[model samples]
Target: MKKEFLANLAEILEVKETDITPDMKLGEKVWDSLALLAVAAAFDSIYDKVIPVKTIGKCNTVQELLDLVEEDD
Candidate 1:
């Protein structure tokens, strides 16, 4: 799931997978409104949870975003 998430995010942002680091924040110029929307949709479709855009916007890194949707198990 993590692999798919990273791949999808990289694709959505039109960047190479190698370019995305765990510490890279999505709020960077690379993530425009459309990218955020796409990420919101991805979270819903992949995690079965509709994460709010504002919440997602607060994320500081790829790892942080992934951690947001991580199950508590």
Candidate 2:
């Protein structure tokens, strides 16, 4: 799930797969908002879960986002 999430995120952000390290700060990216919305939509489509925007705002890394997705599960 984490891999899939990362792949989708990288795709949405137009970042290379190698560039999207788990430790990187998502909000520091210039394309964060669009990438985040894409991630949120992907979550809803793939997991049948809707992640709130506030929760999305609080997540800083792929691991944190994965944790939130797991918690939602």
Candidate 3:
């Protein structure tokens, strides 16, 4: 799950998978609407759940986003 997420994020950010780390700030990766959409899509496809934009906006770091994905809700 983690690996697939990293791959998704890598493609979304157009960066190498090694470049991502839990502590990395989404701001540093230029977090934008497109990235948000991509993340939402990934969650929808991977977990078959739709992540709210509001909840997603609350994530400031990669780990937070990862945690959001793992959440039961």
Candidate 4:
């Protein structure tokens, strides 16, 4: 699930998978509202977890977003 999430995220952000890190800050130009929306959709489809966009918005880093995606997936 984590791999898939990272791959999907990399695709959404138009970056290489190796470029994304758990500790990476989401201050890049690619990390915009649209990306977050796509991430929300990906999370629901990939992990069957419907995380709120508002809740997701609170994430300041990749790890924060990853935290929202529990290991149960």
Candidate 5:
């Protein structure tokens, strides 16, 4: 599951697979609002759950998003 989430994030961020780490911040790079929306959409599509935008904002790292997704499960 973690691997899948990381892969999705890497795709969204347009970064190399090896660049994405649990400690990396999704918003740290130049990703704009559209990227975030795409990420949220990806989360819903893959996990069958809606992660509120506010929740995403509170997540500073990939691990935080993973925790949120796991908690939803």
Candidate 6:
């Protein structure tokens, strides 16, 4: 994932950048309900994408979450 994106997410989730990784699971200790909302808002604000909560629900890792927000190439 992009470093800037990772940093932005880490800040939103209130975790250190070092703590975030592709394998990191969402809804774990650091990613709670408020963090989930922040993720949604981040996508909307950064990418203008409206990510469905259902889609977020299915993501198991930080990579999955980034995939949800990243623009298609």
Off by over 4 Å in 3: none
TM-score of candidate 5 to 2 decimals? 0.86
Best by lDDT: 3
lDDT of each: 0.81, 0.76, 0.84, 0.83, 0.81, 0.79
Backbone collisions counted per model: 0, 0, 0, 0, 0, 0
lDDT of 6 by residue, 1-73 (tens): 4787789888998878898887887766476667778888888888788987667767889888887777573
Model 3: per-residue Cα lDDT over 15-65, one tens digit each: 999998888999998689888887888789877879897788789999898
User: What is candidate 2's lDDT per residue for 11-69, written digit by digit as tens?
Assistant: 77887777777788877664556666877887788877799876887887878877777
Quote the lDDT for 9 in model 1: 82
Worst 10-residue lDDT window, candidate 6:
26-35
User: Which candidate number has the best TM-score?
Assistant: 3
Q: Of models 4 and 6, which has the larger TM-score?
A: 4
Ranking by lDDT: 3, 4, 5, 1, 6, 2
Q: Model 1 over residues 1-73: C-alpha lDDT tens digits?
A: 7787788789878899887877876666398778888889988887787889998888879988788778553
**Is candidate 2 or 5 superior in TM-score?**
5
Off by over 4 Å in 6: 71-73
- Candidate 5 lDDT, 11-65, residue by residue in tens: 8888887898999876776467777687789879988779887777777888998
Colliding residue pairs in candidate 6:
none
Candidate 2 lowest-lDDT run of ten: 27-36
lDDT of 4 at 2: 71
